[model samples]
Target: MKRRHFIAAAIAAASLSGAYPALAETDQVRVGYIADFWGASATAVATEQGLWEKHGLDADTKVFTNGPLQIQALGTNSLDFGYIGPGALWLPASDKARVVAISSVGNSDRILAREGVTSLADLKGKKVAVPEGTSGDMLLGLALEAAGMSRDDLEIVTADPATVVSAFASGQVDGAAIWYPFVDVIRKANPGIVELAKNADFPQNQFPAAFVTNPATVTDRPELVGKFIAVMKEAGDWRHANPAETIKITADFLGVDAAVLEQEATMGTSFTAEDLAAKSKDGTINSWLDGMAAIYVKQGKLEKALPAADYYTADLFVK
Candidate 1:
């Protein structure tokens, strides 16, 4: 071939290569989580390790102190996905919002009581701080019922987990229901003063703290959702292998101590798609939710059974 013809052929080949399809750029997926907890730690790992990008998702993570605000953001379309206690989904779902939980992220929050409180019965008439309407509150209700008491038996105070330590220290509350790290703080400060409720005592152990998304988002962006789950599972694997590093990264993100993150990380287990699928089908997840709803109904926090099974989908974990 002539030189000009050869050059033209090369140019054509280059143009074709440039036009070849590449990975689709995923739409921004905003994920909400309360800081320093397992969910937040997972989000941080996914972001830091580029797992989401590797799975073709551009994840934008947002931190919230409570589920109500996170679910509100989901309803308004400001957030595409979030992590919250499975029971918290009921209030939003009741209001015509749809959320499908993709996986179980954490479990069984501890009820940390101040000094001299030996057991659940010791909490009677004491001030207990919990994030109202959250899994912590639901678990607290269950513990109270198990002890033949009720929220009426104590002074219930609503506060964020971050403030629970100071609240307890200042005598603002005699006890608090909190996830790890914060619970760790209370344990460290008060030593034998804090008592933890074991997972076996309440259905809170299997409670689904999940990766949730609005119905419209799930339907409209199924690929994104799939990718998000894939990345989350990847992050979970990384977290399990690199617990110390994961703790440090999470601590940096939450502006807390690595020791605190380490303590929180130890409090729960992470799941993969396979684990999630088995739990969903075995009715374990549903039963846990049902038990929580029962407590809420008895407490008058929920007027009726809210169809807990509809809020989660095992198919999301199938792929």
Candidate 2:
């Protein structure tokens, strides 16, 4: 049934003019995205190269700082589509939206500790700043659990990632968990800061960035959503083929040096059809989300464990 549906949808999208037509046929799609770093690779590649427009979509890209804000916008029906980390869906608002595609999985996040705080264990009993319910927040949680502690073991202060950096600078917190290029921001401002852990440093913190849509959007316009994923997959393919160019474009978008973005490029894994297929075949993503849901429920942030299938879908990206 899923295969037949995918074939039908793919044929419909391609039959318009040609396979992946470079034509615009719709009004601006208000797309919420992080301008900083989370999903920057694809956004920079896709937007700059007119991938969306090529697929008959005029994406009105709106800059958001984190997954919580983007996911919140989806609940209110403010965004047609957008990117979010797994942590964004940990909140109750997750029920309002569903994941349409998985874009990337990598180590783009890190834990920044004040000079004297050198290890995750040292973060105990200290005020730790985190953007609660975001991927970084989950990373901090997993790291704590790995260390035989919980969020309760530390003074867990909640704020967005940008403000978490500010709070860290103002001496309001002893340690902070954030991802690039904000991690770059802190390292530049205070060379003395040390990384206690990065996403790659922990096995439990494998992060994923996905495109989510309002459930209404998917049901009302599955074809359009399919086009969006097709273009996104194109962008991902292009980034891999033209890594240098995409890196430069991403650097300009984030106002960081190509060198910094270059370093970041090596930090995480980008999703291709093959990667997504392998993970899906092994039920990797769903299993991971099941564990993450359990963690969020244990923390009492969610009312119950939402099914992994409810939060993410690969139907659009299957082809």
Candidate 3:
């Protein structure tokens, strides 16, 4: 499918002229998400099942290559609503956007080592490739700390996800910290590769994926935002009930092998609207954002630590 940065004028013209009778009463929302196995699943499910229209939204979905770029577009008002993983949570913390809901929570990041490196300490003094500002980097930091080591202990090569994969594949780095399906790709290339640690192994790392929007978008279009969250919740319910069908849809949407996704170890946890409402009231969502902010502060990416209330709220989710 062709991805667009802006909604086409023709679409607006058609909606005004009633060319699309089915969409005449619906609110148009420009949705953006990372193009990965899990990132766009809720959007894809809603699209395929006509849930967006049913919920009074005309979703113009856009695919992004990563969380940072997606959040950048969101910050500049190119996207009205979108997904942002832990990697880009710092952007929202800086007041670029607001996280509205928890999209998923699980182990989406991994630290994979070459055959001979069997433990976290084994990677000490070795070369490690990682995307500098990603959930993978968060996992690497946490894992290293758990092992009583730090970035200085390893020759950390900062690279994008694709480059990290390439470096690991060519044996340019002893280990790589990345997310799937790239992790699966590396394992396919070298079956003996070992997993040093994953976000799942750490009880503290919930790896909460977020659904976000510009603060103004939420303030101006409150009901629209509520409908969007409802659609995602409904889609998440369907995915939980129909794992096989969900896998097929996700594979086709991402152009990934169905078999690989089937074997994915860190399939995220889905929540209901009521579940989110309870979590929100209890400050669970805010606490998650606070944790993300702490990671940024530790990395020195953020100064004068911001509270989760500054950048996140459960009002939309509650509504």
Candidate of highest lDDT = 3
What do the candidate models score in CA lDDT, each in turn? 0.66, 0.70, 0.75
Encode model 2's per-residue lDDT on 1-319: one tens digit a residue: 0111111121222221123555457656877776544366687777788787788888777767677788778778788888887666575233767777777776777778989776788887899888777777877877776678877778888876667767776678888887765676667656789887767766754566778888887788888788787777777777767777888887676555677566657766776656775776577877766766777776566778778777666555674
Which sections of candidate 1 miss by over 4 Å? 1-23, 86-89, 92-108, 203-205, 281-284, 306-309
Query: How far is 131's C-alpha from truth in model 2 (Å)?
Result: 1.6
Ranking by TM-score: 3, 2, 1
What is the C-alpha local distance difference test score of candidate 3? 0.75
lDDT per residue for candidate 3 within 1-319, as digits (tens), equals 5763111211122121111223235888899876565677777777887888877898888876567777778768788888877877887888878888887786768899989777988888889988777788888888887888888999999886666776777778999888876676677666899998887687774668888888887788777777787777777777666767877887676555567566552467777656877988899888888888887888777895668887776766766
Candidate 1 vs candidate 2, lDDT winner: 2
Runs in model 3 deviating more than 4 A are 3-24
- Which candidate achieves the best TM-score against the true structure? 3
Per-candidate RMSD vs. true structure? 13.5, 9.6, 7.4
How many clashes show up in model 3? Answer: 0
Per-residue alpha-carbon lDDT of candidate 1 for residues 233-254, written as tens digits (9 for 90 to 100): 6776677667788888876766
Q: How close is candidate 2 to the true structure, as a TM-score?
A: 0.84
